[model samples]
Structures are given as structure tokens and as C-alpha cells.
Target: MTWQRPASVPVGQVWSRFKGRERDGQPAKMSNWERYIAQGVSLACFTETDGAPDELVAFNITLDLVDVFTLYGVDRYLTSSGLTVLPEHRGQNIGARLFEARKPLCAALGIQCTATVFTATASQVLASKCGYTQLAELSYSHMAARGVDLSGCATPTAKLMGTKFHFD
Candidate 1:
């Protein structure tokens, strides 16, 4: 149950090759792939790593400014694109913990948090656990209109959820 804390992102694929050739024979000093390494303010986790603690996550994020408001609108917020815990990690409440981790990062910038997920109780439960309320639920066919491509989705519906927060 050892979780490797967040650290600088590993040298990226493009950069790794650059370093490989530049420092021939010398290994690149990169960060470990596990536990829940935070790169900047990204809400992410690694469920698999090299000999590292079983990093757990099936999540994606969108940092673009979501137009979730019209009156008294805000600019940007952390979007939890998806959070699918591995089958083995089910019932562990990892999603809740991960979402909890995202709060402060947003609060520091005075921004709210949002998420979109299918009707599945799992994700809805996670969102609820994180204090987000459902704003709407859309059909999978409409995903493309919302800039979603569900060819990779396991379900047909994803709910839009959000919550207000402050640093104080």
C-alpha cells in the first residue's frame, strides 16, 4: 500500500529521446511513474509503474475553461474527464481520495471544479463524494456535439457535474 507521492513529470517521450542522444550512455534522470505524481496542477494518477507501488487510476483530465456558467461566469476549472478505477481496486474509495486532492489546487486559484460521467452509480457516487452536483445528463450520440468521442466509452450517457469552492 505504499503510494509514491507526486513529483515532476517524467521527462516526456520527445524530451527523453533528446536526452538519450545528448547524454549518450548516461541514463536520463526521470521521475518514477507511480503513485499519484502531479505534473503542475493536473488531476491525474498512474495505476501502473515500474516496480513502484501499485499506482491506481483510470482517469483523464481537461484543463480548458469550461463554459459552465452564464451569469457571474468564471474562467477556468479542473475537469475530471474520467475516473475509472481498475477492477482490482474497486470499493477502495481511491476516486474519492483523488478528487479530494484536486480541491486545494483549484481553491488556490479561486476556481470551481467540474466533471462529466455516465449514469453509472460508480462515477456519480464519486462525483457526489467530491461534492459535485448534477447539472445535466446527455445521450452518447450527443457526445460529439459536446466535443466528446465515446467510441472508447463503456457507457452511453455521461452527466455534467460541478461545485463551487473557495480557499478560505
Candidate 2:
């Protein structure tokens, strides 16, 4: 079945300004998350709770990375904008289920590929288990060299994982 966002749930946006040595202390790059949400889709996992029948446990937002993938000979693909699983829901396989669900969603949408930047070690492992191949990797120390201090972060590296769906 095709998915449609509920009308009652409005998509929100936030503007991010990047400044530092990477940008030479200038606003070289800016991002609006809502724009991505508007242009793409979000998948969520919910559970029944004592207080709330439908409690959000996990979610993943994806956006089309046509511009970035074109150079690689990929016409279009869904690139993860964000992914999260509630702390209390961790270890329940909800995140893995969410990652797995993307296949049917992509087939329904006529999209052939999906990709994500897995910054957490657990997520990278999950992606590997889900059949996503590592396309590239970026280490936190490398980011620090580029002036982005990701020191003290629990994740030491980020990997770009992608898969091409073979819909039946």
C-alpha cells in the first residue's frame, strides 16, 4: 500500500547555519530539514502503551539524492535524512525492522535504491545485516582534521551504506 502522511501531523523545518574553519568562518552552507521531509518520506514504528495506544518507537526520514547520485550514474535514490529509535525501545529490533521496511516502501514508490550514512556502530552493524553494502566511510578523526570537532562522540566513524532493491 502507498503511504500518505497524516494531515494533522505537520512537517516541521529547522535552519542550520554552518560556520567555522571549514567555512572559513563564513556561512558557506545552510540546511533546512523540513524541505527534505517535504520532498521525501518518513517511516515510523509504533507500539501500544498503557498510557498511549500508539506510541512512537522508531522512525526514519528519507530524501531523494538525485543530484548527488547522478554523477555516480544513479538517477535517483532515497538517502536517509534521519533515523532514531527511542532509548527505551533499543535492543528490541525496532531499528532493524525500520531499515528492512524501506524495501517495500521503495518498491511502492518506484524507487530502486536506498542509502544512509550510519554514524553509530550499532547502526552500521544493523545496515550490514540488512544487506546494505558500504560505499564509503568517514572517520571522526578525519572530520576533526577538517575542523569539525567530533571528539568525545561515542561513534568513531560513519559509513555510507546503500542497496539496490530487487522488487518482486
Candidate 3:
């Protein structure tokens, strides 16, 4: 299926539905969602119809300011951060599809690096499968400023840097 980047607000709503709780354990604030979507540089994924009883599968692409500055001397680099598929949609290639769709955009943007922090084993596996290498295992507190949960989540981040492009 073809993928497109929705406006950040709508993408945030989709993100909120999958992420469930905020770091504070409260229902996620709309502002946080808005922030994430706004911070996201690009997106490649599909959204299911509202009230369709189906899962919405999508991959969110973001640019990390810090990493971009450190590695590329810029404040932006492509990142595939949020990959969510409804339970029923598991085993399908939705995630891969999202990645494939986003790859070209990254290339066009001259994005030679990508980074992401993952808390789930499945996410780690997916990252490796998608050609990202485990670069660091750091404390979640490092990501706290981003509104992520430090205590409950184990932060595993991966990266694909330099002039390498692998789209599968």
C-alpha cells in the first residue's frame, strides 16, 4: 500500500491510541502527542478508518537534534522511531512497508543517519531486521526530556549512519 505523511496532529492521535499511557501514567496529554508529531520530520504508514475495529499500522520518522549536531554537524537526521501495528495486524509486513516507503524520502533528504530508542524486544528485533545496528543501551532517564518513561522502560537505541542505504 502507498504511504503518506499525515499532519502531525492526526498522527499524534494515532500515536496516543497505541502508546496508551503517558510517562506520568496519566492519559496522554494532547500536547505531548502534538509535540511528537510536530517534531517528527516525516512519516510513512497507513491509518485505518475510525471505528473500523481494525489496527492502524504506521512508522513515524523523526530527526534527532542532538545526534544530528554531533554526527553530521546539523540538527536533523532521519529516524524511524515509532512503529506500531494493532495486535490483529501482527505478522503482516505493515512495518516493513512503512520503512520501505520512508527510505526514499530519507535518501532524497540526504539523511545519512537514523536513530531510535526502543523498549520492547520486538522493536529491537525489528530494528536489527531492518538494518539498524544496536549502538547503545542507555538509561531511559536520558530520554526523559522527551517525555518518555525512564523507570518502566529500558532504552535500546539503534542507528544507521554514514552514506549507507538499505531498504528492504
Candidate 4:
């Protein structure tokens, strides 16, 4: 899990080499299309070494919600940039804690709702546990017809999930 792309490896060579790698019966890496959507404000958790953060263990990025204004009836909701936890840190509830932290963040940003397209079943489950409800669902096959291929994913379908945050 401590991956360092060696100088000899091409820019994406390491990723390409392990593109089909699976963990816990699911693909460990995301498709390039999904990677394109992962850019935005990042929230991260790091492990301390000598009382200073030394390694990023988990992270979730937030971006302005897009194309789903009609679904939530708002144009300014927060959405996922992407969420990831180091493979070594998996199964430790770190991902759930990150989602829980978003509530306070949303309130501070004056954003009332949050939404995301959960391309993995595990993420959809986590979203549900975080109180997000399914707003829509699309099959990977359907997405492929539109020019984005998500055929080799763990789940046949992806879900659009959303939730409203209450600020005191």
C-alpha cells in the first residue's frame, strides 16, 4: 500500500500494471473517468509520527454539485470529489468517520445538502449509513453506451445519493 512510482516507471505505468487488481473482491482502483471527477477541495486524515502528521491515511474531496440541481432543486449543494482510504487502513471505520465529519463542514460552508454518484456498492452502503438516500440509479452498461466504460466494476449499477444537513 505504500506505493511509490519508481523513476523508471512511466507516468501511468504503475497504475496500468495494477489496473485490474482487486481487494476484498472489488476493484482496488478506479477508472480514469472517475479519476477526472476526483479533483477538488480535499479533507484528509493523517497518522501521527512523533506527534506530527506523517502519512495521509484517508481522504474525501468535495466539489460543487453539478447536473443534479434539478434533482435536489438546488444548484449549490456539495458533492463528492472522491473518497479514498489507504488499503492498509481499510475496515477501520475511517471512511465512516470522514463522512460524519462532513456535516459540520457543510454547515460551516452554508451548504444545506450534499450529493454524490456512488460508483461502488461499498460506497453506496457507506452513504446509506451516513443518512444519504438514493436519488437515482444507473447501470454501468447504460453508462457505457454514453461513452464511459464502467463495465468491470464490482457492481452492475451505480447510485446517486443525497442528504440534507441541519445546521443549528
**Winning candidate number (TM-score):** 4
Alpha carbon lDDT of each predicted model: 0.52, 0.65, 0.50, 0.66
> Which candidate, 2 or 3, has the higher lDDT?
2
Question: Where is the poorest 10-residue window by lDDT in model 2?
Answer: 14-23
Q: How far does residue 105 in candidate 4 sit from its true spot (Å)?
A: 1.2
- lDDT per residue (tens digit) for residues 1-168 in model 1: 332223433322111000001112322222443333343344544433363423324343434354546432665555644465555444656566666656665554456654555456677767877788887888778877878777566667778787766555
Ranking by TM-score: 4, 2, 1, 3
RMSD of 1: 12.2
Model 1 alpha-carbon drift over 4 Å, by segment: 1-39, 45-68, 117-119, 141-156
**TM per prediction:** 0.56, 0.69, 0.53, 0.71
Give the C-alpha lDDT of model 4. Answer: 0.66
Model 3 misplacement above 4 A: 1-35, 47-56, 64-76, 139-149, 154-163, 166-168
Angstrom error at residue 68, model 1: 6.3
lDDT of model 3 at residue 27?
Answer: 22
Backbone clashes under 3 angstroms, per model: 3, 0, 0, 0
lDDT of 3 by residue, 22-43 (tens): 1222221122333555554455
Q: In candidate 2, which residue pairs get closer than 3 Å at backbone N, Cα or C atoms, i.e. clash?
A: none
* lDDT value, residue 105 of candidate 3: 57
Error of 3 at 9 (Å): 19
